[model samples]
Target: MAGLDDITNKAKEFLDSGAVKDALSSEQAEGVSDKLLDGVADAAKKVSGGKFDEQIEGARDAADKKVGNE
Candidate 1:
């Protein structure tokens, strides 16, 4: 199993490289976010494991709610 420290370090590497920020600025970001959500949901449909679907849905819903959408 991956250690928490290892995982965090890897995440930090991505952020430090500015790839994360670049992704946020790109036109592909929306589609990437949507696909990330779907991937999470799909992962959640299987036996328990780390999944992003719920997080993705929550983020989407939060953004929509913030924008005053139904």
Candidate 2:
């Protein structure tokens, strides 16, 4: 129980941190999340030599939907 309580408190502290608050508040713009996902996907595609471009694009779209505020 103490271990669980410690973990919970640590999580609460992290959630209250200024960096977390700033990231949460700054990423609410339309298409911003998608742009980030797109950049990641492009990097993945390049790493895979375009062989996995479609798969990476699908994953990027899914990630955008999950994290996007728009």
Candidate 3:
């Protein structure tokens, strides 16, 4: 579980890093970030046995708010 926690934390950090924002056009960045975050949420949901649905959702929402989404 520690490994999973680490992976989740790292994924969140990367999403919030603003690296993508710095590197891509606004439209491209939003699209790519949204896709990446959506994928992360899906995988998290599966790995969590649907137990952390709310947290997973919150993570996606945070990413959308911090990174901007289309």
Q: Write the per-residue lDDT of candidate 2 for residues 2-70, one digit (tens) a residue.
A: 999999999999988988756654556336776777788889998999999888988887776655354
Residue 56 lDDT, candidate 2, scale 0-100: 91
The numbered model that scores best in lDDT is 3
Task: After superposing candidate 3 on the true structure, give the runs of residues whose Cα lies further than 4 Å from its correct spot.
Answer: 1-25
Error of 2 at 25 (Å): 10
* Global lDDT of each candidate: 0.60, 0.77, 0.81
lDDT of 1: 0.60
The residue ranges of model 1 lying beyond 4 angstroms of the native Cα positions read: 1-3, 35-70
Tens-place lDDT per residue, model 3, 1-70, is 9999999999888866768556543777678878998999999999999999999999898777765444
Q: Which residue pairs of candidate 2 clash?
A: none
lDDT of 1 at 1: 53
Looking at model 3, residue 38 earns an lDDT score of 91
- The positional error of residue 68 in candidate 2, measured at the CA in angstroms, is 2.0
